[model samples]
Target: MSSYYGRPVLKEPVWKVPDVPAYLYLGGMAGASSSMALLAGLTGRQRLARTGRLAAAVGATASVGALVHDLGRPMRFLNMLRVVKLTSPLSVGSWILAPFSGLAGAAAASDVTGLLPVPGRAAGVVAGVLAPAMTTYTAVLLADTAVPGWHEAYRELPFVFAGSAVASAGAVGMVSAPAESAPARRMAVSGSVLELAASRRMEGRLGLAAEAYRTGRAGMVLRAARAATAVGAGLALLAGRSRAAGIAAGACLTLGSIATRYGVFEAGRETARDPRYVVDPQRERLRERESAGRGEVH
Candidate 1:
């Protein structure tokens, strides 16, 4: 409730809009697309598999470009690779991004050009194996930060991100291979459910921190995301091979995923700008601890 001159106790995030948000969205889409590609290939849906590979390749490449652009230098990103630290989310994320970009690109190239079929499938498989971590590591990266909204929602953030990733990939599949996209539709529906549910749970449990997510610009964007995702899922369920419906659903789902990422990023920024979000929580924790100690002594 109190602060030095009413200034924020924590530094606001320096990440720029569109760059960091785009990186998060594209990386998540690529990771889930790779997994979808691997599964589709194994099931003999070659067209769907190829579509997934292409989507994953493009998304990964764009994601890395956005990240590098945000960093202001390619070398900064490279520096993250100098040492692998399990305790560092940024380090782990860089490693994941680097290999994922290569593998996804190679897989897509081979599938498109019909060259090195064996190697292409192998690369796709490896990328698929790393996809889950790729999709959710960003959540860890955000949650590990000092930002109140993100850190407080750590318990459900990964699930929210994973669901968004899956839905994004599934949307790609729906748009690209509508006729053979039963699996994609299923993923879209299930992922939307998970994303919506986890988001609700996360906000509900955040207590004071939830204000950042429920007010201002962050609130509007997040509300839009929820609406789009819900509508997209409904459309996916009834698409039934209609190319128009599939495309519409895919577009909505993609928009929803993008909105979610930006909304979360902005929420963290909002929390960091308000000293109340920081000071109030710490004070409450101290009070609880003090009360517990007194009771134990008595």
Candidate 2:
């Protein structure tokens, strides 16, 4: 509304409501759970492994449904499979999602169906191999967009997303598994710390474009995310003493992780809605380049 005319440089994301954010959270949880399942299986923690596998499968399934729903039609998603687009983040992400889902499903099936041992182990390994990509490619997808906050914060987004994913998956494990599995508690605490730190660093580094994170609705949501993460992680550290505490910690962590996803999404949307965020950064970049050029001439 100021002198810049209030027109956004980038179109606002058409992906609305629960679909996009839900996909982000579910995909993250699925990826982390798949990794946990593989590690637990290798380490002979059968109960933890089974829980992780089932969680991974369910998360992956729901994530796929969310993606399809977001696409507006099932046919569009099918059409996406017609080509392997190396340059398109969504295309590559779609491919990565497929095998990871299948592998996770097979691993989960082996647990409930008792359908042999070797295939389940093999699927677990394959899913684990793809888990990191599954968790991180969405960061690249969002960063590739023209949105100012997302593109500017690209360096830190992957770490933030990864940490959130680990926290969410660990929350699932803590809720479903016995307290004996210390890895779940450790992962929740460590991941929460990492998520909080990375988000702070990202907000700090974005300069003027980070206004969305400092003010308005975006700021409020992000502050809540920070509070939830801190309390959840802190409680998780002391949760070992009591089962009720463990459940509470798990619930808090899961809520925090979901809040983190929605907060980041909203911040980027706010940045896209306001022209100043987009214009100011570009103007600054141009000014810096001009200054360097003048110095070179001198």
On the 0 to 100 scale, the lDDT of residue 162 in model 1 is 96
Candidate 1 minimal-lDDT segment of 10 residues:
237-246
Q: For residues 57-140, what per-residue lDDT tens digits would candidate 1 score against the true structure?
A: 999999999999999999999999999999999999999999999999999999999999999889999999999999999999
Residue runs of model 2 more than 4 Å from their true location after superposition: 1-5
Q: What's the C-alpha lDDT at position 89 in model 1?
A: 93
What is the lDDT, from 0 to 100, of the residue 275 in candidate 1?
92
Q: Taking the tens digit of each residue's C-alpha lDDT, what string does model 2 give over 1-298?
A: 3434656667889988689999999999999998988888788888888888998999999998999999989898888888999999989998998889999999899888988678887988899889999888888899999998899999999999999999888888888886455888888999999999999899999898788887887788788888888888887887778778778888888888888888889989998888788777778889999999999999
Q: What is the C-alpha lDDT of each candidate?
A: 0.95, 0.87
At residue 11, give the lDDT of candidate 1: 91
Scored by lDDT, model 1 comes in at 0.95
Lowest summed lDDT over 10 consecutive residues: which window, candidate 2?
Answer: 1-10
